[model samples]
Structure formats: structure tokens, C-alpha cells
Target: MVQGVDSVRQLFFGRDDAENDLTDGLLSSAVFRPNYAYREVLSGRKSLIIGRKGSGKSAICRRLAAPDGHPGACVLITPDDAAGDEIRRFELQGVTADTAKSLIWRYVLAVHAARHLALHVRAAHGRRSSRAVGALRAFLRANGESDDARLYDRLRRGARGLQSANLSLKAFGIEAALGVNGASEGARASRQLEVLEDGVADAFASLGCAKTHPPLLYLVDQLEQVWTVDADSHALVTGLLLAAKHITGRYGRAVRTALFIRADIYDTLNFSDVDKFHSDEIRITWSHDGLRDVALARARASLGAELTAEQLWGRVFPPSVRGEPTAEYLFGRALPRPRDAIQFLNACRSVADERGGPVITEEDVLAATERFSRWKLQDLAKEYLVNHPFLRALFAMFENSGYFVTREVIETRFEVRRQALHENFPAYTDSLTPEGVIHVLYEAGFLGVWRGGDVVYAGGIQAPPGPGEDEFHVHPCFRPALNSLGTERMTVQQGALLRSDVDGACERLRRLLDRAPLPAPTHTETLGEVLSIETEALRRKTQGRPPTSAQLRNVATHFQTLADTLRQSGHVSHPVTRRLLDEARSLTRTAGGAIGSGQGSNSEG
Candidate 1:
């Protein structure tokens, strides 16, 4: 029955285009919205590309990795790339967090410098080639890599034995065999590392790398994986920034390094020589038009159809029927991110499919509200969990259906709940100041004005300096779900208050909340699920899909609705039974789809 629809569905959805995942590889024909990042990063002139999660960090990284994505062929080092995991493994090893950051960066620069030499020597292909190759070979051998292995494999593994490289190698092998400790050992290690860097530089000269494919462009991404405000995490991050600053000092022009990073992480870290990292840094900003343009590109790719996002959307969901797209309408429930718009559409598509529908209707989008909320909550958990483990529960107080509220409400709520929340989630233990919470929420787009415009905050909800609304609007994206929970609780309160028993109402509300206790997430055994959730408290974090209780209730409600439809049509006996039996068979046969195998990036870095 659904055979022909499969092709159209495939076209309609296009590629996965997930914000958190990566594409298979660089594609010359991949749809990319031409922007300054392409030019700057390709030129090897920009060292840092900063943006929010859905802002195309990975997209740009993918482009640079493509053969033609940049003027010079690029070497990609993504956060998930296993070959490059060693650089980050420093912290996992005995390296203290405080010192790991710097060491990691230094190691990264040296390793890449060595890689450039390897690429150049191999490219040259002659006697000078062997000499040039030998220099890099010394580096690899010194670093513990097996020299006999194939060249391509070693390119990514780096020289594993770097730690003991210069440690007076057995001028006392006897002392080493005896496990004798040397007080001067640390200095020897440092000197050897420095010496290795010089060797890589010399190899660069020997390869005549300047004549090789322009300077090699080295792209570094996802530093936040190891980043933190702690001294050790900070040191590692600072070392990376220092590498960007002193690029010419070691590799000179043989290699150009670019890092795609989260701006918030960068700003929060305490690093030295900031100007060097900042000098060539470019922040990816989007205009309404800009976002629309990118959205169209993705939509086109997904649909495999010829029209822009606006044209396609208009054809499918015309403004005459749906009204013009307002920021609050298109992005009302989203974070004004292009990726969010795409995902929202995907969520709508998922709902519409069950209706045997071809065109996406307004009802479809609206019906996706709960699922969309879960998606955003999943995102919030993934992005902020490492920093704030109790994110969702901490914000439960503000879930009051106040779309607009005075600042006093926020302050009072925090004042009442701060101590209790702090005790549970230590991320904010030292930061319970109401103002801090306010700033954090605002900066992260959790709270904002009712609408975007100039106005006054007659109440204590002070408007930002120059232009903006005074009213606070729980962001349409996430507030609704939280508010929905509150509304359900309100029903319980209303019944208790009907008897003029105010105390009874208060007691009822307390009991209701006790039952809810912040919607603890159950355990997720899958790694993909783990990757999407970042908090230390994984079992309590939001899941990819909304809570199952809501889903089961929804299913029961749907069955009742179907029975009503069957009665209205007078077809309950045969058609209804047949449909119900088929569904039951399908679920039982498929094992509820959980047993299914299969399958499964991005503006956001």
C-alpha cells in the first residue's frame, strides 16, 4: 500500500542532515551556502571559526576536508575522528587536567608538523624524497610507532612513544631496566619534545614543502569535548589557543591550523596570549535572509526537488492557508537556528507520514509539538549537561505558564529553590545567585521577551538597554512542554480549590509535584543515545523521544478515536477489526521496532 510513497519520501527527506552527526565524507557536489567562512578558512587565513551549535561548524569543517573544499587539499581532524583521539587522551592518561590542555596542543602541533612532512616527502617521489621521508620517519620511530606499518595507517596514529623520546635513552639502559628514578627526567622529556618539534620543522624544509600543495591546511574541531573551567581542562584549552597564536613559530608556513569551536567555551576559558587566537578568528553570524537561504539549500537537498525553501514550503504549506512566516511562527518554537527549522520540518514529516499524507499540513506541524519539545530538550541536555547536570529540574520552577512575567517572579522562584537545587546539581552549587541564573538562561535562549520589539518593562523585567520588549516570554520552543506539565498539575489544584480550601490546594499541588519529581530519564544503553546526552546524570536526562507515559496515553486516546470513527462510518465489524489486527500483527512481528537494525551534521559544530 505504501510502495510508491517510499521514493517520494526518500526525496522529501533527502539526506539525514543531523546537526550532531557528520556526513560520510567531503562531496564536491554537496549543497553548501556560499559564505565568508568558505573563503577565509580555505585561504588558510583564518585560524578560528566560532559559532553556536547549529551554526554550520561541522559543515564548514566538511567543506575544508573535501579536495576542492579548500585551495589546498585539507587534513580533517574532527572531534569524533578516532585517529586523532590520542591528542585528547592526554587527560585520560596520567596527565593532570591543568597541564593536559597545553601538552595536548603542543603535541598536536608537533604531530601535524610531522604529518605535513610525510605528505610532502611522499609527494616529491625521488632521492630527496627518501631523505625528507627519513626525517619524518625518525619522528615516527622515536614516538613509538611501528615503522614497518603501511604509510597510510600511520598518518593518523601519530608517533605513540613521544613521552620518553629524549629521556637519555639508556646511556643507562641499565638504570632504566632497574627502574631507577631520575630527578632530572621531567626536564629530559621537555627537551626531547622540543627537539622533536625542531626535527619536524627541519623535515618540512627538507621536503621543500613550500613547493608542495600550497601550505597544508589543518582543521581542528570540537575542543569542547575536553574543555572545562577546571584548571587542567583550562590548561589544555589554553595550549590550543597558544598553538593558534604561535603557528609560524614551529611549522612556519608549512602548515596552517584552523579550529572550529563553540564561542561560549572559548569565552569562558582562561587562556594566555588571547590576541593571537582572536586576530584571525571569525564568528559565524546569520541574518534572517541568510538563515532562510541555508534552509532552502538543505530543503532542496532533502526534497530532491527544484524549488527554494520558501517556494517549496509555499507550495506545500501556503501562506494563504497558514499565514505569512513570522519569526515567532517559523522560529517561534525554535531557537532561530536553520537546523532547528529543518528538524522541526522533519518532526512534522514524521507525524504526517502516519496520516498517509503527501503534503505537510498545518495540523501536522502542530501535532508534532510534543515530539519537537522532546527533541529540543534532548539538545539542551546534550549541549549543557557537562556543565549543568541538573538543567531540566533546575528550571522546573519557571515552568509556570507565565508566558510573560515580572523579573520578581524569576528572582523569587530561584530564591525559594536555589538551596535545594544546588544540593542536587553541583554545577550551579557555587552559582545560585538569581542574577546568574537569569543571565545563563537568557544567554542560552531559554528565556526572552514576549516578542521582539522596542518597549518598556513596566514591571521589574528590565528591557535590554536600547531596544526590545519589556515582557518575558518563555521561549515557545521549550516553555510549552514545561508549561504543559504545569497545566496538567493545575487541573489537580483547581479541583482541590473548588471547596474554598486554599490550604488544601497548596497541599494538593505539593503532593502532585512530589509525584512528578522532575521526570527522571531512564537508562539508555546505546552509545548514539549517550552521545546525544552530555550530562553526568545520564539516567536522569531527557530522552530522544518524549516520555513514554505521554506516548502510551496518546496511543490509547488514538485507539478510542479510531473506534469512534468506525462507529460513525458504520464499519466497525470488518474494516476496523482488520486494521486493528494488522497493526497488532505488525507490532508483534517487528518486536515494536526496537529490534530493528539500521541506521541512522551540520551547521552546528
Candidate 2:
């Protein structure tokens, strides 16, 4: 039986979040697309997976921890708020803040490795454990690392151990205090951590785990839950990077570490060693094809049927949305990532279900677009809230403006709000300048720079907007929420040709709707739908080709209807209203006449 809208909505798309999606949801082994980033991590070549929020970092992390995941046992560490507080407050007197944090992380990793080794050595390598393995068990038991305590509790214990240099190293045969009495606190702490790590390494070596078994994988994820925009947070992340690198080399092939970090948080690190991890950094970016593949896979997984992409997209969902292929329209407007795609696809289905549909119609997708845009806009701000707390406040600068803007326009907009922004966020005034705001917005993917005939956003190896790049376009993902749909400022000459006059008329009507007040919701809705249809038809107009006589006539009919609707609304006879009415009626007559004479005219009367 063909799946109905209710089933498609309820079953076809999984939960928006991968965490929830993995448990009794659709993000199973069947639907998870093992993209480049996942492959890099799985191969142990990339330990730092950076991506924008909802870019599938956690999904990869969780997938690695699944039973069918990595060849080796996986330890997933997701710090909660309590654990974050402990790390943020941790400081050592004789070491840098980053070093102190690294030591703590090393302790955590070493303990996790030790625990894994103790169990593996007995379970797989036989119950007759080696002396080194026995020592790890003793050490874990003595220091309470053996308990299945929460991450916060473990961090608290490790923090206390490192702060006091009192980690029971007796298991490694050092029953008494260290002889380095005159050393700084940092040296003492480092020496103690080294002892524990050495013990863990010894166990790995003794059991030949490095040679006989796949490396134990440590997957640290969801640091954004604990992240803040402060010196401590910076140190916290920098420390983890250093620690992950350290243990990867220190434990040799016996252990591997991967940290799935949000790009916004990762980009904020500025320590001297930040550049060293370039080789290990794999940024997650989803292509249109990749997203489509994901959508198809998820749909198939949900239906438990071998549904082809065409059936899922063309049959289950409308074939096209607003004159573009449904897939293109959907993914193009979303930040290219799994989470955004999932949320949007599911939202369309939900809307369709509510409207009592067997399939997701164009109306459902259009309605979902606005809601999704609002969600993404708010999410974009929240995604960078730790680093760019003023992000939400900056949205007002783009709201109701054209989606396409030159650097000059943005600067002018920022200039008007610069003082207020500085006053509101004095700590961030340095980044509140026009140039600074542009760069920030560009990095956050809220804006894309026009370069080399394409709108390039962040990720995908695209360079940041340079000083010479004057043109910028608000990302489609955010345009609807900002009500900035007009593309008047776009450099259309760089693309295929467009019918300038009809396009202009459409733009004029949009501007009129934005400026002039209508009588009621009914009129506004009717006019909005008409304009939307006209825009879609225009989008379908072939590139580099003039509108045919039939197309012109169709447009003329739309304009005539628009003119009549405006007249009936009885809008105030203001300049904007009069110009809109005049433009619509004139275009109707001119286009209609051109078609009647079997000639096409792409001009306003």
C-alpha cells in the first residue's frame, strides 16, 4: 500500500536530532550516510571533526559508539553542565590554564583506556590478566575510576587528584610521595599524570593490545552543551585538542581519540598550537547530492521498503516547489547539513499531514519554509551564542531588506545601529563595527559573499569574504525569516539572462506589499499568493531565453488579477500604493497587447 501523508510524516522522517533519532528512530545503520568526515574519523586519520551545528557531528559520534561502529570498543564522553563547570574552574598554579586543562583531560582519557583494557584483557585475552593489567584495575579501584559515575563526578575526582598531586600511583609501584618536593605545582601534577598514563600504556603494551586489537576509540562530543565565551572556555577547548593529540601519539596504536566539535566553538581557539591539528581537522559539509542521498536513505529506512528517490521525492512529496525540483528547493534553502535537511523535510510532511494529504503539496512546503527559516535564524544565533552573543540583535539589520546587498549597503545599515550595538554589548564593541559584523555574519553562514559568479558561504573550503568582495547575499536559509526575499541587489549579469522588466514588476509588487497596508488578512493572503505564483512562474522561465508569448499572456493575467485585487482592497492612495497599482495595470495591458500581436515584450509599460 502507498504510504499516506500521516504515515510519511510519522515514519518517513526521523527526529530532527540525531541523538533521539538513533534510539528507536530512523537514524539507524540503514539511513546514516557515511560521508567523508565519518570516513576520516573511522579511519583514525582525523580526530577533530568540526562542523556547524546540526551538521551531523553528534550523529557521527554516536554512530561510532554503536555496536556495529568502529572495529574497537568506543568510549563516548559527552560532558554535562556540571562537568563543564568543573573544567572551567580548574586551574593549576604552576602551569598555563590550557596545560592544566589538558592534564585533566589526559587523566580522563587514561582512566577510560585503563577501564577498557582491564575488561578486554580478561574478557577477550583470557581471565589470566597480566601484572600491568592487574595494576590498572587496582589503580582504577583505588582512585574510584572503576565506578560508572557521571562524567561530572569523574572530572571532579580527576580535578582533585591533579590539584593535590595525590593520585594513588601506588598501583604503579610508587607507594610514597614523589621526590620532587621543590618542583612547581604544575611539574608535580604533570609527573603524576605521566605516571597514570604510563601505567595505562604499560597495560596496553603488556597485553599486546596495540598489535592484537584495533585501537580503542574515544569519542568526545557535545562540548557546546558546556561551552561559553570566556577565557576559561577557550582554555578548555584548546586543552582538549592538545590532549587528544598527545594521547594519540603517546599511546601509539593502542588508542585513538576523536573530538566532534562545533565549528563556531572550534574557530574561537587561538592558542599557539592551534595550527598543529590542521591535518586532523575534517570540516563536515553536505552537498546537494549528499543531502538528497540522505533524504532517500532515511525515507527508505522509515518505510522499510526499497523506495527509489523519485518515488519518495516525486510521489510522497511534491515533484517541484516554486518551479525548482523539490529536492533543490528544499536543500537549497537549508544550511547544507543533515539536521537542517531532516527538520525541513519532516516539517513539510507534518504540514501535509495536518492538511489531510496523501502527499506533501507545494503549499505545505511553502508554509514549512517560513517556519523553518524562523527556526534556522534563531538556531543560527543560538549556535553562535557562546561566541557571538550579539548575533540575534544583529538580525534586525537584515530584516525586511533585500536578500542581496553590496558591502556599501551593509555598512550603511550597520552604521545606523553601531552606537546602539556598542552600548548594548560593550564587551564586543570591537566586533560590532561594520567590517567586523560582516565578517562575523559571513562566518556564521548568515551571509554569503558573491565571488567568481557564485554565492559562497562558510564551510566547503570557501574563503572568507575578502575586502574586495563588495557583493553579499543573505543566505536563503535565513531570508524568509528576515522577510528579505527581493533580489534587486543581486548581480544578475553574472548568471544566465533574466527578463528584467517582468522581474522588476514582481519586485515592485513585493515592495508594495512590504510598504502598503492592506484592509485585512484575507486581502494580504490573496495578494501574497498571487505574487508567489508569479515569482514561481518567473523562476521557471528558461535562462537566456525570452518569455514566450504564452508566458507573457500568463503573466499579464496575473498582473490584471493583482491590479483588480489592489483596487478592491481600497488601500490608501499613497505614492507607494499608486505606483504599485499603476505598474500592475500597465504591465497587464502591455503584456496582453504584446501577446495579442504574437510578440513578446519583457518591459513595463
Candidate 3:
């Protein structure tokens, strides 16, 4: 069994088949073998393997190319093998606009030729004949007229002779083609490619013997890297797809190509006329179950013991009270893609390391979960702020409200602020305030729906499950970072002045109403006029009286109307007003006073 730093390092960092064997040995009996859409690919089909970075896409590809004890027959060609080297060569050649197109063409031709050589060596089993000779002759005849004709001819003849002597063309020719002997490199490469293609065709023809299998499978991985560096990489990919389709069709199932590509890149392709390509191919999506199985298989291989993926996961990270082990619970509500699971595990490991623990624990998982949630929230914030400015004002409201905010309270508070601002500075009549800002914050994940029938600031907190399997809560992960305008003294001063105004207004309105009783009126209009007169009289008599009892009632009715309007407009319901009304009713019942009789009494004070 492997042990210690070197072994662990090899298990984690080794890239080729040898390393893979160790990994498989370590994990074989556990449970997490990659469930690549292998059946479809092995059945001579094309597919895409899409996943984010570190999603194990590369690992899955490697597994398919080199399964345990299997002399991997597949030829894996990556963009790095072709474009990476080509880009440096172009820079060395002093690339310019005039030569860019030629450089691209050469790059594509080189990659295709390399792939051709690999296929030839795999199929030919070190044999050469008239077909290989004829292909070399044809290549020399065509390209020999170039400036490097003599060098080309010599390399071409040498490559053909190597094949004739039963040597692997790929093993013998690639280095010669790329050798520092600049004068002969291009010609030699072209000649090697010509012979390689002919050898491949001839080998396939021989495979038509009754004892031989009909088709050979070629697995290509990391095709997405081509397009990442170059906008025109799509053309190369399209060409490869078309060529594969052609060979598979012409050979009548004698040869197959299976390409592994990222799903997002595949989606970006123009597949409007899918029938133009092989439309009957199978498509496989790696789901949560598939990822879990891969992890389990890896674990089994590592431990050399029987263990299901779930069991392995539980061993690594047991469930916690704060979160369950459901797939959604582990990887959020979205589909648990391969990358997400791996990242979560990585995060758990990181937390464990930070806390000086050798094994990952449930607490580590929980902490990682919160970290992931906060990252998502930050992403949401960036998206909201960049795409929607109106949300900025809404976010500010929640930030300033100290956690608990209701829609009605926000609207009422904002409207009052807006009116005051309008009166003070008619030039700036906009209603941008803290209340309005809270709404924006809600959309940005800083606030979300809470169980208390109103919105609450998320604050990055996650709720641990309580007794009876309660739902999650808006657990604060970190302290809020919001602009708190004005000092404590300023806030206290403002509150004192506002309270004094309110008290003075209440006293003046009470005296005015006591002095001028409303005259009894039969019609609604006449009663309204009497109430309006009393309201005005109260306003004049009091130093800061809001209005008469009738006016206060009118204002309350207006607030209710506004709340209804906001609800109709799709704003969330406000619980603050309802609570205020409930409190008022309770106070009235306890005091043995009429419901509307205490309006002039400064009960709020």
C-alpha cells in the first residue's frame, strides 16, 4: 500500500497512466469510478463532456483512454499539442497581419497531420508497403516544388523507408519533423504525414480480414482548449468533426471518433442543421449520481475496500445538524454537477487543514457551505449592481434598516423622506432613500424571504436544523458592510428634535379640537368640510400638531390604500403596519379606551 508524502503526492499529482494506476488501486474498492458516458462512446459514438474547471472532466477522459490493465488504444489529441507550440512558433516568425492567415492554416494542417500519424502508428503495427511508398511519392511530387524541396524529398523518402522496415511512424517521424534542422523540417513533416495517412488506410484495409474487428475507436480529449485561445478555433473543431463524420461514414463503421468537449462550448456551436452532422449520436449528461459514483469509485480504489459513494462521502464528511446529506443540501438547490461536488470536498479539506485537523468534519463542511453561499451572494450583488441601478437604492434601505424591514414601512418611510426632500429642494425631487434601497438588496441576496412573514438580511448565516426538521434560516455569515451615515450624536439629535415636534403638535391639536367641536352635519360633504375646518384649526393652534382626529383617520386610510396599491404592483407584503395595528388594538383593549378616541393623545410618544 502507498503511504507518506511522496506516495500521496504521486497519487494526487501524477498525470500519466502510472499515476492513474496508483489512484485506481487506492480507490478501486471504495466507490467513486467516473461514470463517463462510456457505453455510448465505446459503441462508436461522439459525445461532449462538459464541466467547470476541476470538475474531473480531465480525469474521466484519462480513465476512458487508459482503463485498468488495458493497453489504451485511443489517441488523445489536445489543443495544447497543436496550437500551443504553433503560437510560439508564430511569435518567433514575427507574425504580422499579412502572415496571420497562413500561420493559422499551417497550424491546422500540422495538428491534422500529427493526428494522422498517431492513428497510422496505432493501426499499422510497424508495417509499410507500396501504398506508403506511393503516398510519399505523391507528397514529394506535390510539395517538392517549394523552396525546401530537396530537404522535403529526403525526409519523405526516409520516413517511407522507416515504415517499409516495420517501424512505428509516429515514434520515428514526429521528432525528425520538429528537429532543429530548419531547412528540412517542413518538407520532412509533410512527407511523414503523407506516408502516415497511406499507412493508416492500408492498415484498415487489412483489418477487413474475417478474423479482424471492423472498427477502431479513437478518443480525443481537451478539444475545448482550442477555442479558448483563438476565436477562429471553432473552424478547426468544425473541420475535425466533419472529417471524423466523413471517415466513420465512408468506412461503414470500420473506424470511430469520440471527442470530449465542454458542454458550454458545444452549445455555442451552430448546430441548427444537426442533421448535416451525425444526428443519431447519443448525448450523456453527468448528473449528481454519476459524480457521486465517481468519487466513490476513486475512494474504493484508494482504500482497496468495498464502500459505496455515499458511505465514502459520509466517512469524509459526516452529516451535521445545520445541513443534511441530500444531494441538494450538499451542493445547493441546483443540479449537483461534478465540479460543484469536488469543489465542496476541496473546501472541506481546506477548512480542516486550517483548523489543524487531519480528517474533514461536518463543521468543516458547514463552514465551506457558508463560504460558497457568500461567494454566490457576492456574484449576485455584482450582477444586480451592474445590470440594475434601481436595485442600488433598494439595497441601501435594507442596509440602513438594521435587519427587519417590511415593504409597507419602507414605502411609507421613503415617501415621507421623499416629500420632505422635495419640499426642501424642489430641484431634486427624486425619491431615492434607504427604504427604496432595501428592495434592491433583497434581489441581490443580501436579503431573502424569512419565516417571520417578511424579508430579512441574509448576513451569511445558515440555520442548523432544529427539532422536527425545521427549514433553513437566514443565518448571517459575516458582519454587514453598509454605509452608516451620520454620527451617534447626530442621530440622537435628530430623534430628539422630531420627538419634541411630535409632542408639541399633539398638545396643540388636542387644545384646538377641545376648543372647536365639529358641528353636526347630515351630508357626507358637509361633515367632511367640518372635519377639514377642525383639522386646519388644530394645525394653526398647535406648534406641531399633525392634524385633527378626522385628518389622522384619513391619513391612516391613505396608508392602507397605498399598501394595497403596492401589493397589486408586485411588492412584497409588509408586516410592520399589521403589527402596529395589532399593538394599537391591544393597548386600547388593555386601557379600556375606544379604538379611535386616543388619536389626539400622544400614545406613540
Residues 79-146 of candidate 2: C-alpha lDDT, one tens digit per residue: 98999999999998888999999999998899988889888887767767889999999999999989
The digit string of per-residue lDDT tens for model 1 on 33-103 reads 75786678777677788876776676778766766666764666544334334444444234344344455
lDDT of each: 0.52, 0.80, 0.41
Task: Report backbone clashes per prediction.
Answer: 11, 0, 47
Candidate 3 on 1-605: residue-level lDDT in tens? 22222211121211223234435443232233534455545444445444433444555555556554113345455555445334323311322322332323332333333334334543554544344434433343433321222322333333333223222244323433332344333343334444454444553455442125434455556655545423345444544555455445534444556666554455445533446654534434455566656545544444445655455455444644255674445644222345445555555556766777645666776677666554543444443432343443333343433333234445555665565555654533442454334433442335444444333333223232222221111223211233222232443454344334333433443344345432233123323433554455454335321122223333333333333333444432334223223333443333234344232332322
- RMSD, one per candidate, in order: 21.1, 13.8, 16.3
lDDT of 1 at 46: 79
Ranking by lDDT: 2, 1, 3
| Candidate 2 deviant stretches above 4 angstroms | 1-11, 486-605
* Steric clash count of candidate 2: 0
